[model samples]
Target: MEWAEFTEQSHKGRASWTAIQPENKRTATDNALALKEFFQRFPEYQNRKFYITGSFTSESYGGVYVPTLTNLVIKMIQNGTLPNVKLVGMAVGNGELSADQQTNSAVDLLYYRGMLGMQQFDSLKSCCVDNYDQPLTYCNFSQFVVVDDFGNLSPNNNTNDPKAIQCGKLITSFAMDSVWATANDVYNSYQDCYNFTSLSSGGLKGEAGRRTWKAIMGSKRLRASVQQSQDLQSMFSTGSNPFVDQGALYNQGSTDAMGGFACYMDSATQVYLNLPQVRKALHIPDSLPPWVDCNIPVNSQYYHQQNHDMTPVFQSIIDSGYHLNMLIYNGDVDMACNFLGDEWFMENLAGSVYKFNLLSDRFAWNYTRGSFLPQLGGYVKSWSNYNTTSIDLLTVKGAGHFVPTDRPGPALQMIYNFMHTGNYNNSVPFSLDPQPLLPQFAAPPKPSFTRKQADRVWSLPGVTYELNFKQYSGYLNGVPGNYLHYW
Candidate 1:
């Protein structure tokens, strides 16, 4: 906890909670060992079990490139350079494992998911007991708020009651704009459900930045949760509504009622990746420019780059004694990487690098049994070093910011009981059989103008084709101060 008591008790300042990546020519440990030498030059990826992920922890490029390419593929299987790289465990859902312990657990996880309600959680708990004498859950506020199964209060529930001196002047104006802004009210109240209106300039990831990047390339709950039930009943035969909104990630206005359910999953994933038998069953390769789900110039180059504090490369990969199992999950309506800031970053890296006697206390994992529905599935805390390396720190119940797209069956039974039998104890009853294959990608190139290089013109006066571009291949003029798109 000592980075000056985690920056004056989670005021989260000295920056660096993970960014600085913009170079892109390559290097995130050389694109994770060039994707483990393209899956060890494929042979149906032999003994496979490789799972590695990182979705948003701020202007992502898989925030810290998926945990520095899963610690350089566990330092190439502890030096033998990928000795059969089984690498069974590493999960980061909700990224940023520590930007000041997730900006001190995103202002008490938006006031325990009431959305800073209980009168702004008692005015940020009496402005942290009158300026740091302590309490507002010791300024980090920790976790709890569960209420879902349709009873409501789950759209990332930024706790609510609204008043503690206007929630201490809206948490000191979002901690003066970045202790990551106390987890930015869990992404403006649960995945941009709404409430951002300041717009004279840009902040909150530049409000409506490029129409929320063309409404997340037409998001439909991220393209019908990856299709297939008769191709999602013949491409949604009147069922598509992953929360009807398409202002793309926020700034919906005009009395914002609906617009930004990842913009209809980025416009039905550009017609399910330009169909044609799903691009010949995912081979793609026609040319390359259409599917775009939030790429405003690589999220404006990780939102104007430069950031770091990777908590000493996460305490040099758990004090590098290396054995690694680390899970560190979260979703309790994630305000992007919130699980009380990775449970105070594994209780401040188990009392600052193991000396604090291999910690372990917080528990409760619950499930109740329902292969596809029941869940409490949250709360856990573990840490060990004596037995080489361990760390759990979990939470998933109800979820948000994509914990397998919000609780995909308790996030696949808590990742198949923490990767086949390491059992993270959710009081048993998880049951797994036939549920894992959703990571397929391959189909993306083919746009440089087709259907007769389509064109048509009209300047305004109730515009016709909104200016030009008849078919597909780009060049959409739309004149007037010119808004081009030359394919």
Candidate 2:
């Protein structure tokens, strides 16, 4: 689709789509049809079994929410945004793409946004429909990550920079084209240079774009699924009574039913008598009870159970085919669609791909405490019985809410390796493994504060009580243990 047409469809009633993400939005037939046509026009990805990936496929529909650390867009190398990347033209020096064709080629991302699991579509619907509500302003900027290209199906030991490798340029280039509200003259035209604060102000990416444009275009919507979860969980207090009211209302207010004031739970009516004014007394508002005002980000356990609603449709796609495989990549640091959340998702997924460790040069450790035990932030697998369907939850080291941003190299290699081996590669650690051992520090001038373990065999005399003479060798408040070893 041309950038102009892309802008038209993005705001036209279906006011919620971001052009470069893989979020699968439930869309009207016309838009879906248009998407299919757009992909058909692209020579590189027209056919040959296409599989889409990104945040859009998994994001919950809602209003203009902020971009949690999980918004993969910032991590993904969007086209010309990276060094030596070929946008509309080509890799500047590599001459891989022509400048004239780069813009059009990158614009193809607008198509990818429409093509992949249709996350952008779902996000669009949520923005324009599902989450429509008057908020701080009639104007709003909704930020939703539709698709993520973080290498779930990364290729093998192929160590080539993913950007320079096959399919890399194409995907990133499209991502670049998808940005209009922030950059690009094409999107700027529709933006009409509508000026407003960046979406980051509300602690969000403003996926909808400039406030001026959003207000003029229409009210942005949030996905109903996530909104529902947030709504329900928000009502419960961690306090004594998790719920204020349910089914029916009962009152034990002044009446201590059994001498001691016992909150009544009507098994039949499912109402609570302990609540101040039971449902029996109030005019039950049409919406959630007035007492529900809590914040439950998707990353919280409150919203943890909601992901089951987001099982990727692509899972079935892999099962439907024979010689194919699919992977679901997640960055652990993403507070929203975090690594742990993905882990929980995989645990629930019924599959047969073998589960194992990611052996990389990065930090690796096994914790003895089960609850506090971290996966050391690496990959764990969920595979299919026939070796086709698989989901590998790859954890990033020291990564917070966003993996690509902090550990882009590992994320990139993960995808590269996935594409290389249709199965998990236990050999590749998260990084170079520090195999040479960081130069050893010439014996550290001491033994790393001492590995001597306290129980050492002393061959010398019993006067063993050595003195530091006031200052000396080993580690102590100021004194060295070695000084104590002196006679």
Candidate 3:
């Protein structure tokens, strides 16, 4: 098929695409009814906390996953511009070829070999692993972290996967501002996962180089060959380079009839994976940058300055007699930020260290993973339960860096349990309003001083202490004393 032909085919995309729109365009009257419906369904949210998040909120994956090198390679093969590369062999399996065909396993191996940096090829090949079979581990060497204010995280090793990492960092770090902070709140606690020592002079440069990125970088190149995509079925006379490490090509796994060795993805598949991502890419005509751009019109270089953005706002919310939950969730597949970062954030919350020791409580539910899934999210009750006020780590099952996108069901369920019962329940239809958590932790009355004493201490003009020590802060004219200290 010609590029022009594929372009023409793409025109019909909008006819079938999904579009999410607000009810009645969300006017005051519409929102009033929405409010009415809200109260009708769950009245507690009225003037209470609410949250919505996902890739849509983060604006990650703009362009969806198109323009990706893999996607481009796919398109090139589809157009027949890439020679000797059959586009059809992309996703098709090398499982069991018929008498009439042989497998292009080598090519498939090569593609995954490059795309997945440190991933094991054997595990990757198992991705076509039979049903109920173990598929490849996307990034198996990853670790979980529990550190300072950043909470738990599991960031992807390859920073070059900028689209996935930066965009995730930007969105996860800031997108929930309205829910947690008011007007400019951001908190980024994600950490880099790759080992830095692997790059140094005396590090993995020698022996590890075999598995080190440098070795992989040195020994690979695809020999691009082109043929008319329209005339895809034609058999070429030339065949194998039996001596080469990557054997001669044959159709591997993709559905396209074009018989070249290739990795190709068309535009439609991308939209199906993430339509909103495509929309965002289209919106940013000049630069579909991943993560929040430095020039995001804020602190310029002070971009990931999330701590700066969030700390004061958190204090403000505490001051306003409101409850705030700073939650960080991660999807395991997301090779970007890991849950280790979220662990870091939680441990160091409120500028100090905390720990949630693995509880020996009898396991409550079936935390075991179901078929096709890997690890399920589980939580151990904090040792200091019935403890003091602070945010808690809320884990979701089967999620990735983009937790909401991957496991919105569990996430929403957790938040529902959070705001409603102040607990997380894995069970569906978990009891709502299990128990009211009317916060008894309101701000104490400000400290006071006699009129003359305040005048001497603060030196602010016209100080009048109308109320006594009853309204402690009457001395400072509503200037709140430090809740942790001034008392």
Candidate 2 Cα errors over 4 Å, as ranges: 1-25, 28-35, 43-49, 55-308, 311-324, 351-377, 423-487
Order of all candidates by TM-score, from best down to worst?
Answer: 2, 1, 3
Residue range 271-348, candidate 1, lDDT tens digits = 788777887677767685655444445443343323333565566666666666767776766554566666666676
TM-score of each: 0.29, 0.29, 0.29
**Model 2, position 140: C-alpha lDDT score:** 17
lDDT of 3 by residue, 1-487 (tens): 2110011111112111223221111221332233345445753433333332212222121111111222343333345443333221111000111100101221222234253233433433332324215544232111111111111122233556544454333222221111112111011112121111112112443122222221121111111123222211211111211233222233333222222212121122333434556656656443543322112122212111112112232234233332223333333222223333333333444335334343333222122222323234445222222232334444444443334433444555554454455455434353322243356833343344344433332233475755333321222233555323221
Candidate 3 similarity to native, TM-score: 0.29
Clashes of each: 41, 77, 60
Ranking, lDDT, top scorer first: 1, 2, 3
Candidate number of the best lDDT: 1
lDDT tens readout by residue for model 2, 203-303? 32332223222221111110011111111211211112345453223322212111111111111123342244664465554454433212222112111
